[model samples]
Target: MQINQLTRVYRYDGIDLPIPPHLADDPQGLRAYHATLYPAILNAETVDAGVIGTTHVTEYRRAVGTKG
Candidate 1:
């Protein structure tokens, strides 16, 4: 007999969803899960409206290009 230790749980608004071992180990899977579970809230119109500033990139410089 074998037993697997449980890890990772998603809790929101009194909801408790267990994360499978395989999904917990996968980074992309975890992100996809969240995106799927809360698409409406995550994709709310307010999110786009909240971004009011623009980042102007004046130059492109690779910080790691020159190693010390």
Candidate 2:
């Protein structure tokens, strides 16, 4: 199947958060929705982890940059 047809999964805190049908293809909207569930996500970075078993895995990685 094409990448677009694959199910998108957001991995956060060792939990998988599947994207809602309504928020499909809306990256910004999905971020906003996810932030509601995980406030820390507001500052997190979206990292694409590639496909795995028919699922497009993505990770919300916490930003850790030292202010220099």
Candidate 3:
């Protein structure tokens, strides 16, 4: 899987975090990455609040010839 695009920012627990362009393609990898930072983000009081964002993914496939 490949990530075609990512939102400018992601809002989690009332905080806005800048989305890294080179995020992992797997869902679990992405979640684990966020989980590592959620603690500080949730505990911080100086972070600003913002709306949630989303990520876009794209998959490429090639057509194969088959016998008639």
Give the candidate number with the greatest lDDT.
2
Model 3 pairs in collision = none
lDDT of 1 by residue, 1-68 (tens): 97555334444333444456778677456545654766532432211112123321111111234445
TM-score (all chains, Cα) for each model:
0.34, 0.80, 0.34
Q: Is candidate 2 or candidate 3 better by lDDT?
A: 2
Which candidate leads in TM-score? Answer: 2
Clash totals, every prediction: 0, 0, 0
Across 1-68, the per-residue lDDT of candidate 3 in tens digits comes to 87554434444554544445567345445444565777543332332233335533221112336647
Error of 1 at 21 (Å): 2.4
lDDT of 2 at 9: 89
- Residue-wise lDDT of candidate 2 within 27-49, one digit each (tens)? 99999999989998999988999
lDDT of each: 0.41, 0.88, 0.43
C-alpha displacement of 62 in model 3, angstroms?
40
True lDDT of residue 18, candidate 3: 43
